[model samples]
Target: MRLALSGVSVRIDSSPIVAECDLTVEDGERVGLVGPNGSGKTSLLRTVYRALDPFAGSVALSGDDVTTLSQREVARRAALVAQDSTPDFDFTVEEVVAMGRGPWLRAFESTTGGGDATITAALERVRLADHRARRLSTLSGGERQRALVARALAQESPLLLLDEPTNHLDVHAALELLELVKDLERATLCVLHDLNLAAAYCDRIYVLHGGRIVADGPPAEVLDPELVRTVFGVTCTHLTHPVTGGLLLAFSPQQPVRSPHSVKG
Candidate 1:
């Protein structure tokens, strides 16, 4: 299914957070959302997932308006792995993953054998099958994040929304997670703090700044040094990665790196 935000805006206490944003991700596309801190990436994602309502405009999936759908209907359409997910109770990883099936389950109903198979498959996809018996509180930061991802995968939605899914991962795990997303046969909208990772995995990108989308294009066109400086207030150099052949961003310590091809305008 296609995911789209058409001139969507959100406000809290009369202050706008997401302002007239419009973006589209075709089926099976991996689209990245990147911006500096507090740029409303999460807020926009919340609108898409129905956690927040848009003050103006709408979020639509496959020509159907999301606001009109019931919560269960929306849950069946979009699965979200939020930026900050913490389990308060001491639930086992298997139990936590099983929660993803809640939308499809009737009240007082238990997980069936088929549900168990799906949960296990999700955990295995994230390479966390060995930790299924562990308690949520016992897992490390990266492990917890992967468990959350497994839960999202178990939802089995055609559209997936993720907020900094690699927040606490080491270099290897981070890249591996990106690879998993890249290989998935679903439309994915991911908010990534690491520009290089987004460039490496995403087929296209939308650059948000100050509550609005300022740039949208392929990685090579959108991640230029001048645009990064203007939007992120950082000085950086861009190079092509040897292994992946994707754009690699290298930062300057005290001074901005100047290159002729660097569009600073």
Candidate 2:
């Protein structure tokens, strides 16, 4: 499922959060969204997943305008793993994952035994199979995040939107989750804060700043020192991994050195 945002903008309480953003991801493409905090990366993703309607402009899936589709229809096409997951009830992890089949169910329908099998499969994919019967509240932070991702995978959607899916994960768990995402042959738009991981996994990247997309291309072209400084307000040196030949960012707290004549007295 190809996802596209054309001139998309969103406002909450009369304050604009996402401003006229235009972006696209082809089928089975892994696209990363990255920028500084509060740069509207999440907001833009929310629009793509139909969590919030854009104040102006359109979101399309496979070239069909998503606004014309019902929420259920949109849910059938895309699955989202948000930055946070908070369930008030003490639902078992398996039950939570089964809900991903909601879109396929008839009105007033309940999950079937086949649904249980699917849920089990999803949990296996995220390595949460052992925790299937466990209460969601009893899980650790990383376990909970993995469970949420498992639920999204259970939805069986062609397009997946993940908002900081690695937020609470330790370094190993973070890489494990991203590795899972990389292996998924689905159209994906992921909001990621780790530039190195994004460079390592994503096929292409879109750099958002001040509610707009300022850069889009391969990680090598889009993640240079100038772009890093402009978007993140940080100094960085780029190095190529010997094995992968991909860009690796080495960060520094100090600013770039000025040329002799350009230095002010």
Candidate 3:
């Protein structure tokens, strides 16, 4: 499914966060959102998932206005695997995954056999099949991240909203998550901090600064060293990766590197 944000602005307690911005994730594309701290990347995602409504303009899914749909209706179309989304209590892994079916369940309806099957399959997809009976709180951070992803998968939504989905994972696990998302046949809007990973996996990228889109295009076009220095206030050695032939970035602080002997010793 396609996601379009047209002239969208967001505010918090009367303070503007995101200005009128136009962005889109074409059908079956994996789009990346990248920016420095406080750049409103997460804020824009919240607006897309309807957690926070835009102060101006609109967000549409597959050409339908999201505002026209109820929250449950929206859940049926978009599943958010956010950075801070954790279960309130100690729910079993399967139980947590099954919650993704909330949008499909009617009031007073219990989960049917097929629902159990779906949850099981979701766990397996995320490689957590053996942990199905484990308490969600008992898992490590990376394990927990995978379980949450499994929950989103169980939702079976066309548009997946992921805000830093690799936060708690180690390097290998982080790469694995990106690979998994790339293999998915769904539209994904992911907020990523690592520029190299963004370049490796995203079909396109949008850079945000001070609540507005500063630059956007394919990873190579948008992640130029000059743009990185300007927006992120950091210098980077940008190059084509020798192994993957993708973009490679090594960042440093804006100031010149200090020599150990130059400092008072």
Candidate 4:
């Protein structure tokens, strides 16, 4: 599948949050969206997933414009793992995963034995099968994040959109989720805060700044020290991970680097 955002712009309260941005995820490719806080990474995502419509440009899935499709058709084409929780209906984990099948349900066919199996498999894939009976609201923040992912997994869509999926996960869980993303044969556009994780898992990375795409390319090319220092306002040391061979971004909080010539004796 292919996902494309062409010169998309999003606004809230009649003010633009994202502007004229074009991005793409080709078949079986994983793309990362990264930027500083309030840079509008999520705003672009919201446009693609149809939670927010773009006032300009277009979002297309497999060459078909999303705005032209019905809501159910859109859901069948793409699944979103958003940061915030869905409205709480006091559902269990199993129930939450099963709800993902709603888009596929036929009229008057509310439940099925196969649906239950699908839900079980989704939970198991995320290592939450044992917690299936637990209340969705009661899961820890990380666990809830996993449940959200499990819901998207069960949707079985060819296009995946994720926003901050690893926000609250522990190290192991975070890695586990990224591994799942890497293994999936789908077009993925994910919003990620952890640059190292994006470098490790994503095939390409796009950096947004001031609501524009400031930089984009392979992780190795886009994550240079100069770009990191300028766009992120921090110093960085770039190196390859000897074990996995991915880019590792070591950063320092914004601070002045004293020059020898400027130092007084």
Which one wins on TM-score?
3
Mark the regions of model 2 whose C-alpha exceeds 4 Å error after superposition: 112-115, 256-265
Report how far off residue 140 is in candidate 4 (Å).
3.5
Better of 2 and 3 by TM-score: 3
Number of colliding residue pairs in model 3: 0
**Lowest-sum lDDT 10-residue window in model 4:** 109-118
CA shift of 260, model 3, Å? 22
Over 1-265, each residue of candidate 4 has an lDDT whose tens digit, in order, gives 8899999999999988999999999988999999999999998998776889998999998899988988888888899988875645988888788878888889876643434777788888888989988898888777777788788888888888999989878898898778877776678999999999989999999999899998989999998888988888988898878997777888888778789999898
Candidate 2 residues 192-248, lDDT tens each?
999998999899999999988999999999999998988898888999898889789
- Give the better candidate number (2 or 3) by lDDT: 3
lDDT of 1 by residue, 1-265 (tens): 9998999999988999989999999999999999999999999999887899999998998888999998998998999888777667888888888888888888898864444888999989988889888899998777888788888888988998989999978998787777777777689999999998888888999999999999999999999988988888778798879887778889875476678888777
State the local distance difference test value for candidate 1.
0.88
lDDT of 3 at 2: 86
Question: After superposition, which runs of candidate 4 have C-alpha atoms over 4 Å from their true positions?
Answer: 112-115, 257-265
**Superposition TM-score, candidate 1 onto the true structure:** 0.92
- Residue 20, model 3, lDDT: 87
Model 1 residue 230 lDDT?
A: 88
Q: Per-residue lDDT for 243 in model 4?
A: 92
Q: Which pairs clash (backbone N, Cα, C closer than 3 Å) in model 1?
A: none
